[model samples]
Target chain A: MSLSPLGASRSLAAVFLPIKSGGLVDEVCRRIELAVETGLLTSGQRLPNEIELAGALGVSAVTTREALSQLRGQGLIRTVRGRSGGSFIADDALPSPERARARLLDLTRLQISDLGLHWRAIAATCAGVAARRSDAADIASLRGYIRPAAGDGQGATALAWRLSASEFMLEVAAVARSARLAREILRLQADMGTLTLLPFGDPAFCEHIAELSEAVTAAIESHDSGAAEARTRELIQTTTNWLLAEHAAGQAHTPGTTEEEAS
Target chain B: MNGNDAAPATAELRTLVEGIEGRIDDWAAATTRWLNDAGKLSGSAIDKFVRPTVSDMLLAPGSNVTGAGFIASAGLLGPDRSYIAWWQGEDLERVDALANFSPQSMSRYVGAEWFKVPVATRRPHVTGPYIDLLCTDEYVLTFTHPVFRGDAVAGIVGLDVTAQTLERRALPLLRRIGPRAALVSAGGRTIVCAAPDVDAGDVIGPAEGAAATPIGRSFTLLAAAAVA
Candidate 1:
C-alpha cells in the first residue's frame, strides 16, 4: 500500500494511538513519524492550524501545541503564524538510518537483487560524472567526508565510510552543474540510504564500502571516467547479490512453500 | 422687436422648444431609471438609447450642446471609438475633459502618483469634493465600486455623472432630502467631485453606511431611498 500525497490513511485515529498511549509529547512525535512513513505528510508541506489539528485528533489545543513544540525541538517541523501561516515539515528532516530502512522496506518490498540493479545504474552515472568533473576542491570535500572513519574499528568505521561515500557522490553530482542529474542522484541516494539502515549490521557491507571508496578515489584521481563508472556498478551489484541470497535462503526455510514456489 | 407683431411667432417657438426639452428630459430620466434598476449599464443598451434620444437632443441645431457617452475601464474609454458603443462624443474634447477630472487625473491634485492602490494594502474607500481640472464649466461626481472575483479584486465599476447635469436634474431634490453622498472605489480613490470648492479627499474615507456589500464588479448601489 503506497501512500498517496494527499495524506489519506486507512485508520487516521489508530495511527495516532501509539503516541497517545505513550507520553503526550512522545505521542505527537510518534504520529509525526507515522505520518511521514505512511506518506500522509511530506517535506516542506504545511499542517493545519494547531486548533484544527487538535479538534480533529480529539486532543486539547494545548497538548497539540506542546507536541508541535517537541517536534520542532527534534527538528522535524516548523510553525509559522499570522493570516497565511501554519506548521510545515522542516526541509532538512530525514529520519535516522534505521527508521529510513523501515520506510524503504514498507514502500519498495524489493529483493536484494533488484535493489542492486537499481543502485548499479544510479552509482555508475554518478561516478562517471564525478570522475569527469571533479577538481582539487571536490577531492578535498570528498576526503573530509571520509575522515571520520579513519581511526574507527570495522563495523562503526564501515557505517561512517559508507555515509561519507554517499555524501561524496552527492557532492560530485552537485559539481556536475546539471540540476536534473543532481536531483536524480539525490533520489537514488535517499532510496539507497533507506536500504542500508539495518544491513549496516553486516561487516561485509563495511568492507564493500571501503573497497568502493578506494576504487572511486583512484578513478577520480586518475580522471578515468569509465573505470570509475565500472567500479561503482560492480560495488552495487555485489552488495545486491548478497542481499538477494540472504532473502532467498530465508524464504527456503519457511514452512508453506516448496523450492519451486520459493524461487 | 415689437411685442405685439412678434408675440404669436415667439409663443409658437417657445412651445416647440418646451416640447423638445420635455422629451429630452423624459428620455434622460428613463435611461437613468433603467441604469439604476439594472445596476449596470451595458454598452449595447447604451448604444440603443443614447444616440437616438440623448445624442439627437444634444446635436439639435441651435442647442449648442454636443454630448457623447462612453464605457470607461481602467481610466480609459474602450478603444472602438467609431462604434456607437465606443463613441464618447465630439472626439477628444469630451474625452480629454473627462480624463482631466478622472481619479487618475486627480491623483496629481493630491501628491499620490496612482489612482487605485494595490489590493494587498487596500482599505475600503470613499473620495469626492475635488474640482475636475478639465471640463471647467461643470462639476462631476463619480461612484466607483470594486469588483472582486474570487480572492482577488479584479477592477472597478465607475458611474460618472456630470454635476451640472445632476444639479439641473436631481440636486434640488437631493438638497431638500439632505442626502450626503460620495463616490468611492474598492481601494477608495475619489474619482470626481460634486462640490468643487470642498476637498474630495476629505469626503472620501472608508465607505460608511450602506456601501460595504460586495456587489458586482462594475455597479453597486450604496443606499437608495425616496427623496420626498
Candidate 2:
C-alpha cells in the first residue's frame, strides 16, 4: 500500500489527485459539482442524458442516475422531465448583505482578529509567491483585473466594485501555483466578500480601494515580493480594523446602552 | 543542544513528514480521469460534463480541489469563445461567474497562467501562488491538466487549492521540528515561521542553522535550533 498521507492507498488515479474520500457515486457527484461551482454550468443550463454523462465519466449509467439524484437533493441541480428538458443548475439567489452583516455582528472582536490574521497569512503568502512566479503575461493579467468598475448610486454596481477587488486577489492566488492557497482564499472571500463592502456609497472608500488595487498590481508586476505581501497585509488589516470598530460601536449604541450612557 | 533534549522531537517530526508526497500525488492522479472525462464530450459540453465535478470532489471533508473547470481551445467554441463552470468557494457558498459574459472583460483570462501553462506544457502541471479569479478570489495553487480529443488538444482542465488551508494544517507539524522551525514554499514564501521575528509571507533566504526538508513536491519545512 502506498503511504498516502492521512490514510491507506485506494486507487491508482487518486494517487495523483488529492481525494479526501472514496467511492464511484462520490466521484460522480464530485465531477458534477465541479462543473456547476466553476460556472461551467450556469443557472438553467441543461445537462446531457444519464447514458451520455455516464459515458463521459467512464462510469455506468446507473451510477450517473444516482449522482443526479444526489445533486437534486442538494438543491444544486433540478431535473425537469419532458421534451427539451433535463438536469440544470439550480438558480441561486444573490448574496444578501444583511445576512453578511448579521454574521459579522455575531462574531467577537477577537474572532474577527483571528480571521483577519488567517486572511493576511493567506494573502501575503500568495502575494510573495506570485511576485516570484509571475511572468509578463501574469503581470498583464493582474493589470487587466485592476481596471476600475463603474460604481454609480446603484447597489449592484457597488457590489460589482467590491467583487472586482476580490477577483483581483484571487488572480494573484492563481499565479501562486498552490491549489490549497487558492481554496483558502475562496473560503475567506465567500465569508467576507459581502462584509468587505466599501461602506457603500462612500466615494472616498471606493477611491482608496481602487488605489490599493493599483498599488498591489504594481508591486506584483515589479516582482517585489516584500512590497506585495506588505500591501496585502495592509488591506486586510485595514478592513478588519474597520469591521471590529463597527461591531464595537454597534454594541455601544444598542437600545438599553443609551440608558447607561445617561446614567 | 543536549542529545536527550532534542531526540524525541526530532523523531516525532519524522513520523509526521513521511507521507505528504503520496497524498499530493494521489490527488493529482485523480484529476487526469476528470480531464479524460471532458475529452469524451464535445467542446461545448465541457462545462456541462466536466465542470461541476470540481465542486463535488471538493465536497469531500478534507479534499482541497478549489476551482475545477475546463477552458476550451481558442477556436473550438467559436469567435466570442466560451469557457464556463469555473466554480470556487470563498466559504461554503459557491461563487463563480461565467468568463465571457461578465461586464468587466475576462478576455485577459485566456493569457493567465492557469490557462496558458497547461496549454503550453501539454502535461499536467501545478502553477501559481497567484490570484485565481475563477476559483477563489485569493491566492491559490492551480493544478492544470490538458484534455485531448483525437490527435489535437481540445481544452485544459484544472483544480485549485488555497494557501491558507496549507498553513493552518502544516504549520504546527513544522513547529514540532524545533522551537524555531518553519515551513516555506519552494518559491521561498514562508508558510509558517516559529521565530517571533519571522512570520508567514516573509521571503526568507538561506539561514545559517536551518535544515530544510521537502514537504511534498511544492514546499520545504525548515527547522533552526538556536544555540549560544
Candidate 3:
C-alpha cells in the first residue's frame, strides 16, 4: 500500500519495472505474488487495474488478466464486481515453506551474504536510534509486537509470527523517529520477505529469537544504544547464518546449480 | 536587510502555514459543532461524522494531508478511555487505522503531544515532524485544534502532513531565507532544512552562526548563512 510517507513507494517501483524478456504471464504472476507474500501488498489492499498493471509490467492486458486469474486460483487474491470493487489481496496470503525455500536457494551464496550485510547495517542503525529516542509510549507499541499474542493458536502459524516480527522491526524503525530509516527497513523487509523469518516459524529458533529480542528491548528501555545495535545485529546474523547453511546443503545436493536452474 | 529580499520567503512561509491551518480550522470547527450539538459521542459515531471530510481532505488533488480525524477525550465516552477515528491516506485507498479500537491502541495516543498540547492550551497547536506511530507511521507534522463542548474540552481534532511533503514545499523558500536555513520546532527538532549536514527530525544543536525568525507560533526559521 506504500504506507511509508517518506516515499517508500519509490522502492516498490522496482516491483513493477518493465519485464525485459521472460514468460510474460508467469513473470507477471510471480511479481504480484511475491509482492503480496512479502507484505508489500497488504491484506485487503486493492490492486492496480488490469490496464495499469499491464502497462507497468510491459505486458499485454490479456497476460495481466491471465496472471490475475492464476492469483485468484491460488487464493492469493480475490476480485469483486460492481463499483468500489477490484481485486484485493486475501487475508492469508502468507509465504509457503516450499516457495520460501526455493527463493532462498535461487540466490547464490554471495548474494545472500551481501543482502544480509546490507539489511543488518540498516537494522543495527535503526535499533540504536530507536534505543536513544523511543519513549515509554513508543515502548508500549513495541511491546505489542515483540511477542505475538499467541492466544487462540492463531499466532502459532508461520504467517502470524513473521508478521509480528515484521511489525516489531517496523515499529522499532518508526520509534527511531526517522521516516527515511523506517522506509528503508520496510523496503528491505520486502526484499528479504518471509525468508528472514522462516526461522521464526520453528519453535526452537523462535524462542531463541524472542530471547534476543528481549535483550534488544531491554537495551532500548535502558537507553543502551550500543547493546541495542549489537542485539539487533546478532538477531539478523543468526537468521542469515541459518539460511547460508541451508543454502550450502541444498547446493551440495545439486551440483553446478544456478538460480535459474534451481527455480 | 532589505524588505524586498526578506519579503518573499516570509510571505511563502505564511502561505504554507495558512494552507495547512486552513484545513485544521475547518476540521476543528466541524468537530466542535458536532460535539456541542450531539454531545460526546462514541468513536464510531464520530468516525461516521468525520469520514466524508477526511476522504475529501486526503483524496483532494494536491492535498498534503496523509491522515486526519478526531480523537475523543477520556471518560467523555463512558469509560475512562479515549478513541481515535484517524484515517490514513495511501495511493489507491485510505487505511482505517486503529481498526480494532481495542483499549490498548486507544490508550497509546492519549498521551501524544498533538492531543495534549491542544487540550492543555485550549488552542490550536502544531506537533511533530516526529513519527506518528499512532496512525500513518510517517514522520509527520500534526496540526491539532481543540474541540470543546461549552467549557469542557471534549477532545482533539488533528491532521497529519508528511514531513516529506513539508520538505518539498519549504526547501525553496528556506533557500531564499539563506542557503542553510531550517524550519525548526520550538523543541529544536528540524522540520525542513536547506543544509546537507542536518535532516528533518534531527534535534540539532545550536550552530555558532545561526539566527532565528519566528514562523508563526510553532516554529522558527534558523539561518546559518555566516558559516558558509
Q: Which stretches of candidate 2 lie over 4 Å from their true place?
A: A1-81, A87-92, A128-136, A148-159, A174-184, A190-194, A197-203, A221-226, A245-263, B1-228
- Per-residue lDDT tens digits for candidate 1, residues A1-263, read 77773566646656776643437657656767555532336678776667756644446788888888888887889887788888887886644554544444344336455656766776678678667655565577566554344555344643455456565666555434334555666566555554554455567666666667677767876779999888877766766765565555555565565655658
Ranking the candidates on lDDT from highest down gives 3, 2, 1
Residues A1-263 of candidate 2 have per-residue lDDT tens digits of: 54875455556556788655438888778755654433345676666778757655557898889888988998888888898788877886233456567777777788889989999999999998888766666677677656344433234355556656677777788677666788888888766645776353355666666677678778888889999998888877777877888788777766675577689
- Write the residue-wise lDDT of candidate 3 on B29-119 in tens digits: 8777878899547655776788788888888988888888777788777777675666767542333232222354454577667888889
Which stretch of 10 consecutive residues in model 3 chain A shows the poorest summed lDDT? A152-161
Docking class of 3: incorrect
Q: For residues B21-47, what per-residue lDDT tens digits would candidate 1 score against the true structure?
A: 344345434544544455444434554
Per-residue lDDT tens digits for candidate 2, residues B1-228, read: 344644565554444433333433454454445455544444446545544465566676776555566666666556555454455553433333333343123455666666777678776555644545444555556666666655556666666666666556655655555667766655676656667666454566546856776654566666662311
Model 3, C-alpha of A56: deviation from truth (Å): 29
Candidate 3's displacement at residue A120, Å, is: 2.7
lDDT of each: 0.47, 0.63, 0.76
Query: Model 1 off-target regions past 4 Å?
Result: A1-112, A147-162, A257-263, B1-228
Displacement of residue B42 (Cα, Å) in model 2 is 3.9
C-alpha root-mean-square deviation, each candidate? 29.4, 12.9, 9.6
Best by DockQ: 3
Task: Please give the fraction of native interface contacts (Cα pairs under 8 Å between A and B) kept by each candidate.
Answer: 0.00, 0.18, 0.29
Residue B152 in model 2: lDDT: 56
DockQ of 3: 0.20
Shift of residue B56 alpha carbon in model 2, Å? 24
